[model samples]
Target: MQSNFSYQTHDYFNFVFTDDGSVGLYNNIVGDIYHSKFGARTEAEEKFIKPLNFHKNFFKKKELNVLDICYGIGYNTKAFLNKILKLKYKGKVSIDILEYDKNLVLISPFINDSYFKTSPDISYILINLLMDEIFNNKEEVMEILYKSDNKKFIEPFYRRLIKKYEKTEYSYNPVSQNKAFLHNIYYHYISQRKKRYLKLPKIENFYVRTYFDDARASIKSLNKEYDIIFLDAFTPAKLPTLWSLDFFEELFKHSSEDCLLVTYSNSAAVRHAMIEAGYFVGKIFDNKKHPCGTIASKNKLLIENKLDEYDLGLLKTSAGVYYKDSGLKNSSQEILEEYSQRRKLLNLESSSQYIKRNKRS
Candidate 1:
């Protein structure tokens, strides 16, 4: 696929690979949240990777399913996996992903393999090697790579492979290596290189793949029955269709009673949409003293977040629209005001001094 990245973001790290030999990170995980090339341990951990771990601890469940909306190069997916495995989630935590970009899948090996190669574990190389062997029709590839097999630690990776990897199917996949080039690349390189992990964030029990274009088109009622939904689409501005309020309402229809819908956005319109969709919405634990980001759910009295004041004020604003209107030909003050009045009529506010103070702030 061609590189559609027109601009690079300094803060967010974006990893992109074109089949035409351009492998670079555009550095925007949408807005200023993360960068691709320099995936700092702090931001990567705080915003995306670390948050998944936080959920593991915060929720304290053995098996949790996370539906990753914008499953990009899958750094977040791998990050979630690394954390879950570290936490030793024995029950099973599945992550279903929806990604439409094939560029991510195709060049993932070259770039991801390079990243994993930096780690000194021979088993890392061996498992992905064995992965290649399974995908390929090679008769003795795993045996050949495991020839010096005195290492006892790697036997688990092998056993884990049967219990999970080789047998465990992708609910959402990168792409099949059925093509000649991919197959040949696998067979040729599996043994020679140090073992690497596509394991950026991999869950043992579940991995569901979804196409980007089809994501909107394929919004089935059953799809919304997730425990947690990671709303990681590109952005509402760039990808307006994905962030529509109507979709939120549809998602709410399928939501579990205690489900938490999470995302990196703190947008007024997006928050408004969640409210319109029937979620008792608020900010998530931003790790700072103040609450940050958004989390919407069915629980009316879920923990009040840092965004309580800001969002409450917006609901009372002159520009208070439940969500950005994609149906409009143009957005103007008049349109916003119209929606604001509509919201006002719906009694969307609580009369509190905190709400007034939030407006002033």
Candidate 2:
């Protein structure tokens, strides 16, 4: 018997604060946590950032373009910023991020700097301040604001910030005293002025554009090449649209010759999709967890410690028969049903058999 107000409160309540002070969400419909219970920021650093080899690669490139997929709460994006800022790279850095859920975007401004205690370098002070004003009247903004409220409030603020700071320049290694070096946030769904590209505020030679559409459709429209691609989407079983072979093909097309894509999933299906989409694949090692992620790149030299023979063997089994969207428009149920039928057609090896074979090999 929860009222509308209660339902709204419930939505906010679903975001639970972790030990690191970073927030994690409970997906009520899915009965799962959006991020790992261990730590959200921790996972972003250990799983995505470290594996990217940013320090080694950033200096070699004149400009670095990043595509952060399903950019939930902007953890991976922020982590990327944290790394590059420390290195003090002077080259142009651009990020094209995708997020389907507007609620997460709306909630982002409310998340204070304290929420990212684990990553103190990524301050959300400006974003939090703006969000505070939007909800100043509380009731009025809440009532008027829905999913579509983005263009009205969010986009304009971002535009103004970028315009205000577009001409500013900085040293390759600027002092920390510069407030402009802190951070700037921008996101969009379309390609305007040759790819809806909006230069990020304060930070010199930085640009960002956000896509509010589903990754499957939006990613295909991307014409620019990227250096680092962070696949921070939901689980493959739950969110198949972003992990499908068709989607990976779009990624491969938009990626630079040496572009490297990282994901916190060691899922065989994801690996299979990446391999099938024409990329050298490898594992992302974590000291706290098992080989916890997969990295894919067009250049074989970029993929350090590629999946060994035993791990590659897993792809031949049922685990490798990844999900497909049948032209990238099928619903999750439809995709699952199709995958189920596909599984039935193959005499795939059981998990135990695969393990036994791997151990023997």
Candidate 3:
């Protein structure tokens, strides 16, 4: 990970490096990766990104098996848990954290103002794991899901309480402003916050999972497609491969009859990629910053919010680059350029056509 990054809207600064080379937030007891420059308390209260935070209204609990591809230090993971916790449902909700660089995770706690700064369990784990893994060089940290045989360790010890089914009780609601209770809530939010992650939820009509890794590998799992997919990764500027049409089609191949891939970006390249990937991409609920957001699916009716109004200029503006490779092929500048040309040609064709922007806005 890069040593520095600045928030687009603010001059706020965060030094993400820790002494041990962890990629996480700091000053937290339970060890959460800072979700954004705003830190934990504020984001939690405001419900993280306001628009993205509320999508749960459209989804059912335990019914969605989410995937968090970048699982970096687990900030978003924690935020996601908080959201569902609010919903209070019981279904099979399982999230897999791909810790490609556990070192970044390990060194994260000491960074200062980390989301985990206030949690006790994270403090304990950070110490215990440091003793076990850092100084001792032991790999005792394994997936809790795999070691459910020890109910005590998995439950109260590590917070993996596996009940017979999913329910609102699975969510760890913060009961107080008490520092200690807050700590427990934070830790529970990370490990204990689940309905039934016992086994990977079967891909089906009712359940949609988040894919947190490279979209290529994620595509294979589309054997059971999704009703809703939170298509989040770093913007394509950093990882172009994730945005390509090739990966989108892989998701399309296994999609349920009505699937909606929701993402924050309204980048034109990504929009075009969805089209090439065989999805009928449409606009989302963007007021203006983004002329249109994306809701792509094989089934057009799946789109919840469609952009009926349009400013002809957006048809040609440079939205952030989209991933245009529609199949599982290697993407290149040439491929993106070719797609750009196509978009230009289409825009020219539509230039004579008049459309209305939302008059109300």
Q: Give lDDT per model, in order.
A: 0.48, 0.67, 0.43
Candidate 2 local lDDT, 1-361, one digit each (tens) = 1111123432432556655656666677656677787777677888999988887766768788989887766778777777776676668877786776544644454343243323333434324323333333334334323324233422333344333333342331232312333243223322132364643434446666767677777776788888889998778887676788878888999989989999989999899999999999999889865798999999999989789887888899989898876677777777788888998898699767889877897
lDDT of 3 by residue, 40-61 (tens): 3333223222344345444553
RMSD for each model, in Å, please? Answer: 11.3, 10.7, 12.8
Give the per-residue lDDT digits (tens) of candidate 1, residues 1-361.
2223333212244434423222334534444332333342233335555433354333466566666666554545555544555554555555555655533432233233223433312223223432433444222323322334312312233333333333333441433432323334433454356454333323235444444433444454145466667676655545544566766876677666766777767667788778887888776555664444677778765535635555667655533455443433223343445555676777644435545766697
Model 1 ranges off by over 4 Å: 1-24, 27-44, 49-62, 109-204, 221-224, 285-292, 300-306, 324-361
Best candidate according to lDDT: 2
Which whole-number lDDT from 0 to 100 does residue 280 have in model 3? 74
Sort the candidates on lDDT, descending order: 2, 1, 3
Candidate with more favorable, higher lDDT: 1 or 2: 2
